[model samples]
Target chain A: MTQPLTAGVSLKPQHYADALACRAEGLWFEAHPENYMAAGGPRLAWLDAIARDKPISLHGVGLSLAADEAPDEDHLAALKRLVDRYQPALVSEHLAWSMRRGVYAPDLLPFPRTQAALARIADNVDRMQEVLGRRVLIENPSLYLPLEGHDLGEVAFLAALSRRTGCGLLVDVNNVFVSAHNLGFSAEAYLDALPAEAVGEIHLAGHAPDANADLLIDTHGAPVAEAVWRLYGRLIARIGQRPTLIERDDDIPAFQDLMAERERAHALLTRETVDA
Target chain B: MPDGFHDRFLAAVGGDEAALAPWCAGPAASAGLAVYRNTTAKGAADALAAQFPTVERVVGPAWLAAAAVAHAADHPPRTASLLTYGEAFGGWLTTFPPAADMPFLADLARLDWLWTGAHLAADAPPLEATALARLTPESFARYRLVLHPATRFAGFDDGAPSLWQALQPPGDPPADLELGDAPEGLVFVRPGLDIDHRVIGAGTLAFLAGCGAGESLAAAAMDALAAEPGLDLSTVFAGLVAAGAFTELRTLS
Candidate 1:
């Protein structure tokens, strides 16, 4: 029987042996699907070996769902291939655009929150679900720029998006704290406003203060910060338990170190399960 | 309420701060814009560094990063799959003025790119020596060898192949990054998970080229002999078959 995914860490190639060997309770793994989109290779072999023992999640980084144009067909096809191969426990992407007119930027780019964007992103989400033949979770991006022209707040926009497309939300608590800090809003209020039932998954990662500015950049290079953990507590307290993931993409430590943080999230989740 | 806020945002991120003036709500846009700029540059450089490790080792991190930044300014990634990004990076290096002093850098990049290709190629059961033994010695001349799906080979006019092989792990660092005068060839093959690579000779290169081009075994043998006399034809054939180089041995009907 498939174990219920409680807490997970982003899988890295360096720690494949450890990831496969270590069998902690409710321990799963998540990987950026883009990295494994090749035809066949050692990477695929490694993923196959790991997925045999644990539930896997395919978190995409470059779908460009909110681009002015539709999601790239080839990208969608590649993602579908992985979904079919892995049969992951969860699949998620960001609520931001990274491609502009066939030219792709690496980062999850920001856009002015307007009525038109909401409609476009909703349509894009519909297309993605249609192609994958499954519901996907859309996570809010960490904001750095505050631009003009917002027809609705982010929470309302996300809530409406879920209602329209029958999709779910992957609420990244660190993003809430970072965006709230950069744009001068209350992170607690933002988390409190999210419709609890709409959240299907949660992401917790670290951030670094920009060297030149007072803003915090979503670097994902350090351990989870105290403030972000507080925000996570605030979120899960209201939303109940969800499949939480610890993401560390840069300056990665050994497998044991990441599992240490994963254990914290796991402990909280297990406690919630017990309390319920 | 402009029609193309996406376009304006794209322009702004492309380094034209004036394009976002109409929607500028605050004066703190400098740090944010700079942040985005830095992210984009970092993303491209990181991808390049990951894809071209050999090139980085030759040129060092600082030079590779600077070149990666300059290259991305004009040639941003065309697709979201960064695993195969920098397809033109090797060719582009030839145009870089700083890289002019290091002509071998481009060739090294090409070899690295080929290694990646072989690593990601589709899996197939390697051709075995036993399979070749099925055919009679006389009838083998009428057959052709089909190259493996995961087989990648490159022949250089100089010793770039040897230099690349020496730089791979589990080996001591070479004394210098100088190319040799003699020509050399490199072949990468993966029958299973682990990839196998080695320096080859002109005769083997010709034989493999013939096999890749669907030439008859006898024809390929002629080409190999023409490329290099005194080449042990039987020994080279058996070695290649053992290395998982060919997928099939077909008769040329």
Candidate 2:
């Protein structure tokens, strides 16, 4: 039976033991496949132990689906190996591109949302899904630079990509909020525009204010801000409940502290489901 | 001009201010561009820090972070798997003027790189002592043993391995790291979950090196003896076996 989707925390190496021992109802764990792409090691061992009891989501940060090229075959093979081994509850990549030629930037880079770019990314997503033999989720990237050549709004672009590729969306609410604030848009309208049925998972992560400018960088280094929480409540209320994850990549707190935030998300999700 | 958004954005991040003007509405867009540049720099720097903890310990975090950022610009990662990202860093440090005064720094970086390899190597059940004991004396000389995928070792002209071993424990590194005259051999292995290393002798180093090259047991022992005349081969061989260094054994036809 598929495990009931509920609020989960991003599994860090430090919190593996706690993650294994915790018996929170509907608690799941998410990790970046990039970190676990090893031939063998203690990290894989830890993930093995954790996945034995918990449902894992293999969220990838480096697939570079939006690159003006196909996904790397070796990278796809590695991801396939992990999927075959772990059988994660969901697999996800971002709408951003990180690799160009042979050099990788190690960040979720932006590109113009033009029709040609859309067709290329859709084709890339189709190849990724075909290679994995499963419908993967493509996430919306947080924008920083105000590029002028976008042919469609972020929501419309994502919706069109999902429609064409038959891939699900992993809506990062924090990313939506950050992108909206930085680019002068409405987070509410952006979330409203997404096809609710296409969203398989929702992500809530922390962002920090940029030091030099009035910009909110998606740093994932702090507790989820109140504004983002309000947006999360709104998104869950509209899209119904999905597998919401509280992602804290940098400056991770104690497992219990993170679980507290996760519990808040769980409570909200349960309340929304019950209300529905 | 419209299709050049990606190339222009990349160039702008690479520090070409004019490349982004085609995409940007005004000067205010530079702030957003700076955010991307800073985040990319941080990601590369953080990965380098994780891969080279010993280097970070020796040079201090701030200095190493700055150096990592600079190193990343010259040799950006070619893949998203940052685990294998800093392969060129040790060689790069050899030419870095700041690290030139510390002649041992490059070798130290190389040791750290090997340590990472050991840490991430494939998992396997180590060969048991009983497996080695079952080999007949007649066939022992003709047999070849496979080193564990996690096994890595290197020899240095000076005692850099000793200094590296001392700095392995997390604390304030010793104020003075003396380079002894005697050469040192370092062996890294992950027989289990955690990676461990030990100082070895020149003879053992040559034996392991020969074994890695698929030499017969007799040839490996000969190389060991040749490297260190009058060496006690039994002690070194038994120690490595006990360390879980070899994973498989087969007889050569």
Candidate 3:
């Protein structure tokens, strides 16, 4: 908590020693809490070492908050245990749902944003916050299919959810670009519309063209694309400044390669301080 | 009946491609649905590959992925924390027609699963090397040697343990996937960060089993000798002690 986190890279096990040894200012690490839910292991010990020097963010991917039912109590308890142990600088989950009917799909599966759906998700978020005794940021999901029967737009729905539950947003800039291209909307317009106050964290990751379709998949396998970087720049300019993360889940490169990208975000985030 | 949008979309992603028509229109519909389906399958496949590395290495990536996709249909992940997913995969493999030819695969999978259990089991300090040395023969009969929280062991009808150990690095590739007729077992002990695994003898397996069942040292030793009369009890117990297998002695109050 001594140095404000300007930007961070997603922590991978391979880079644990480097992450711990690095002296970069504001270089925190984000991790999927699901990966560290084990009772005991070297993974937890590694996190403890790195987190001692740098901030750690427990960005959960499996809470399934948008599911119709209350978020799974056991998942919430596991999350609570992590929150208590790490005291993470920020915690977040997606606006999408993956668990349904006792079956959990791995992807951030979408749901029709209806008025009823809104109520269910709000309650789910409430339960998550209540159980953890903290407010969590909800990241927007990248849309693939355009579903009918939505009661609100993505921005409006998120805004409403924030108003109702006092949660924040972890906007993944690449998701905006990909969703807008697939759903036939303006990426810039979507960024402009997000309530600046609700913006708590930002994510930048790579995407690839779907082999069989006219869609961009959030592969996180490659480096951040040019267009997404532009969107991230525009978003931070509007929202002033927030903790940003560079996520590379698959096809990870060397620690130095990711730090180069992290430095880009960090430089942009800091320049705003001088300008303002 | 499928209840609503959540239910219907899940069904579409679950394969009823026609169900995608209601949510999306035209060619884009199928393509979008395909993306979801592929992503879902890839997620499960990737987790499975990591969970059962030896299986993947033996059967090849393509075959393992095929099996993972098929197994997921009936036993889709019940939880999103996938580190421990595929709990039933070992048993499920027995019923998988493809695995009928490779009869040893089920036991291999079970061995792989035990490795994961030991990897994530709770941490605890091992018993002092000489905790049993000072015990009176009379007192030893009433006391138990407690297994460490991170200790795991399993017996196999075939040589699955030896096969798995062969698949580990520094060791050459195994000769074949053929199951040896001789019965074997494996034991895992994590003294520190690194886990130590060894192909255990039948007597050692029986001794650990008795300890796991909460039997006294004297009783377990009897079973160990019974299982393998030639098992040098002193040397075997000392070897287990050196491996950091037991946490403490459960003494009578």
Put down candidate 2 lDDT per residue, B1-253, tens digits, no spaces: 4566667778988888687776784656888888889989999999999999889888988888898998998999988889888999999999889998888888888999999898889998776777878676567687988899999999999999998988887666888977777999999978888888899889999999999999998889899999999999888988888888889887877
| Cα lDDT over the full model 1 | 0.90
**How well does each candidate superpose onto the true structure, as a TM-score?**
0.98, 0.98, 0.97
lDDT of 3 by residue, A1-276 (tens): 878889999999999988999998888999999999999878888998888878999999998998888888899999999999999999999999899878889999888888888899999999999999999999998899988767799999999999999999999999998999888999999999999999999999999998887899989888999999989888888888799999999999999999999999999999977787
Instruction: Give the docking tier of candidate 3.
Output: medium
Q: Once superposed on the true structure, which residue ranges of model 3 sit more than 4 Å away at CA?
A: B1-3, B170-172, B175-179
Poorest stretch of ten by lDDT in candidate 2 chain B: B1-10
lDDT of candidate 1 over B159-214, digit per residue (tens): 99988887887776587877998999999888888889889999999999999999
DockQ of each: 0.83, 0.78, 0.67
- lDDT by residue for model 2 (A177-262), tens: 99999989999999988999999999999998889998999989899999999998888888899999999999989999999999
TM-score of chain A of each: 0.99, 0.98, 0.99
Model 1 chain B poorest ten-residue lDDT run: B21-30
Query: Candidate 1 lDDT, tens digit per residue, A55-125?
Result: 99999999998888999999999999999999898999999989888888999988877888889999999
Q: Which residue pairs in model 1 clash with each other?
A: none
Report the Cα lDDT for residue A240, model 2: 94
- What are the per-model numbers of colliding residue pairs? 0, 0, 0
Q: Which stretches of candidate 1 lie over 4 Å from their true place?
A: none
